[model samples]
Target chain A: MALTIAIHSYKGGSGKTSFAINLASAYASVGKSVCLLDVDLKAPSSFNYLLPEAKHWVNDIFEGRYGVMDVVKDVSKEMGTKGAFYVGYSNPDIVAVRGISSKDRKWQSKALKLLMTAKRDLSNAGIDIVILDTGAGVDFTSVNAIAVADYVISVGRPGASRQRLMEQVIGGVYMPLDKDCYIIENMCHNDNPTDLSGKKFDLPVLASIPCMCDVAVRCDNEVLVLTEPDHAFSKKIYDIMESLDKITS
Target chain B: MTDNSSTEEMIRLLREISGKLDRILIQGSADNESDDGILDVLDVMTLLTLPDHLRTTATALFELGSATADELAERTNKERAVESNYLNQLVRMGHVAKNRKGRKVYFSIGEGLGK
Candidate 1:
């Protein structure tokens, strides 16, 4: 069975997508069939990072325009890596982006069911893990995605509003939903203290990643962990993946 | 540390960050800035839009497991005829599942909306 992990944050610009891609690549590196899905339909950046040489999109699969299997692009060959590393990207087209956020009640239920079916299909495809990079904050896209996840890694940055919202969301949303939530303090300034797992938040702090310009540059170009495995940022990504491998196994 | 102190520190950090802005852009937490309103097909189905009696009936069935229209009438305080009409609407909406047993209509929240 595929263990679905959702990388979420209460606000944007928290390195949420970057971590999702890094973790998925890490799992693939360890000889696991991994699929990184960009469910952040409104403003998807995963397609920009991962090589999107495929035709079908995640939005098409989500909106019932295409089958889940049809949209999954086998990216392991392109990335020059081993194991299955597939990417199901969201539609970056202007018109299609506007249509994915459906509000109809009956349609919402069916869409939820579709996501469930997609998970089953992914598992049937022998995918070891399905990592979802959802839209930031508590939209239905994020909320529903988080609800379905087997595990959640909430990415956070050093800010006031972001921190406060993270606290409230954890207490009000995640706790009530009975979710296993782990916090990752991402893009930390070098000057700040690390090891905030329990000192700062109520949940287990999975990893503390320092702000690195090299990773940011790669994020703008290619998947950082895959392109430059020797980089410090990439090392942290591997460390996180190693920790996750233990927990999920 | 107590959750209250941690929460206070979080509020202080929030204020400190907002203080760096050239001018006030946003006030309070972003939780209130939910754009997930009923503007599109993907936004969550609003529970607020559901009829009060239908919601009550669903809640009653959710707690009771399954109840006949007459049993629901006593719990929801609606007459048999009135309760059955609402029950039929809920069944039509798929909010409640109906089973027939010797002219009695038992309703319970089922499938997608039940949980």
Candidate 2:
């Protein structure tokens, strides 16, 4: 079974999805069979950042026109055989899918089934890990994705709201599941070092990623982390992967 | 019903019900199993009267069990409390066991539960 890691945060704009894509790509660069699933149905940005191959299978799967595996394309081909990388494509109009009604019980049930199916397909494709990029906030979709993961990587920026959201998620959600959830502070400015420390945020800080405009611009252009490992952001992503390996192993 | 058909149907239903219950459990809802006496009732139900459908599914879930709440949460997208309660019920009923190594609670199917 592939280790399913869900990159999630309760608050938006915390670089959750971007970290998921970059981390998945980083793992792939090290010869790990990795698949990045864009489960953030309302805002599916992983496809735009790491798998902009102009073709995705998400629409096909949603419309009952294709299996999920048909859309798992190798985006790492451009990185020269460093490792295997595949992105599960999603339709840009995925919000229109009938199974996307977050409040509907039928939709929730169907979405869970879809997740399980996606996991099976990804595993069968020899993916060693599946990184799920979840939507922000404590919605049904995010909860369902986190519930089914082997590891929950809570990504957030250092802020009061972000810290509170992390506490709510970890205390109310992850703790019940008894999961090994780790917190990652992204886009940390050097001036604010005590942002997440002390009695306020008691959760372990797995890694801190510095804010890098160049990396953000490249991500906006749909670039992979391995494509520029020497970059500051890429190195930060590499450190996260290493930390994850240490904890998971 | 034929024995084979009944067994299959039971397993199917158990799988669906267990999946549903598993979702609720993963969400970290406070099931009324906190009282030791109530816990005993749940254990009896699980051991004796739990529908065949639920039995099969619960067995499968326990068998392919996660070692940590984090692992289970990562797999199910559920909150920690929900998963803990579900695992607690299983543990109380002797269907699951928790291995405490250092600070972590690793859950797996109990050896007593015939696999």
Candidate 3:
């Protein structure tokens, strides 16, 4: 089976999706089959990043209208990778988002099953890694992803409030679930590196990515690791990739 | 032979045959249970009865069909002892069944469950 990873955060705007796409791309760049799923049904962003037109969305899959393979968009050739790269995008339409948000627990449970089946199918199709860009907080959507994932990368910016929220989530949710959890401190502005030792939880820090003004201002969805290989942000993402490799290996 | 000696021998043989029958009946019942418990194409949402942690463990077991605590620990990124604890919890909840094979114990979803 492929290693399933859910990139989650305590709150929004933690650069979770960016890290997920870049990390998926990093894996794909090295000839590893990768599938990046935009599971943040509430706020789908991979569309802005990839801008690929879709015949189907994850919503349709959850509703049992389509299978994962039907919705998977292969971009391996476009990515110029030796291995395949596939994406399962969430519906980005307003009605679609509202519809998913309105889903009850029963629907969520069914959706989780569908996702599990989809993951197994992906593994059978030779995908090496499956990365889910999950919604923030303790919502059912994000919990579904966390439940299915083997490794969780909880991304949070460097701040007291974010840290407190992160600690609460880690202690309350991740710890109880006994998941292999890691923290990624994104958007660190301090000159000196931020220390994670003071945190309440014991999750290892995967990377402390410094904020880049240029990358922030670019205002486009192109993966920095793929577009600008020399960017500092790209290097940080690659470092995260290496750390993941070392750990998962 | 004395009459009492012959009767005692007959009783001993009957007791021995009864014990063997009991063992065979017990083994047959277990086999029936195993056959009945073979979950196939089951809806994964049937696991909602369990807590999230146990549900995750059960789901992992469903994926694996059957696995030891060590193998489940690898899949779940948890300590072997932790996985063992959760597996035992599932066993208690009747969501999973454990069997010993050699020195290793393997667990799988109990009945009417699949990934």
The candidate maximizing lDDT is 3
Across A1-249, the per-residue lDDT of candidate 2 in tens digits comes to 889999988788888777887788789888999888777666667456444464655545544456667876777777553677877755556555444653343335334445666777778878898988888887766776776687888888877655766776776767655557778888888876424445554667888888877766678665457567787888888888888888778
The TM-score that candidate 3 achieves is 0.72
Positional deviation of B86 in candidate 3, in angstroms?
9.1
Ranking by DockQ: 1, 3, 2
Model 3 residue B12 distance off true place after TM-score fit, in angstroms: 89
For residue A105, give model 1's deviation from the true position in Å.
3.5
Q: Candidate 1 chain B TM?
A: 0.53
Backbone clashes under 3 angstroms, per model: 8, 34, 0
Runs with alpha carbons beyond 4 Å of true place in candidate 1 = A190-201, B1-115
Q: Write the per-residue lDDT of candidate 3 for residues A126-145, one digit (tens) a residue.
A: 98999999999988788778
The lDDT per prediction is 0.74, 0.67, 0.79
Ranking according to lDDT, highest score first: 3, 1, 2
- Per residue, candidate 2 scores C-alpha lDDT tens digits across B1-115 of 8999999999999999999999889665444323322333222123223443334334335324446866665555567676677677677776566789999998764433221
Best by DockQ: 1
Using TM-score as the measure, the top candidate is 3
Model 1 lDDT, residue B43, Cα = 20
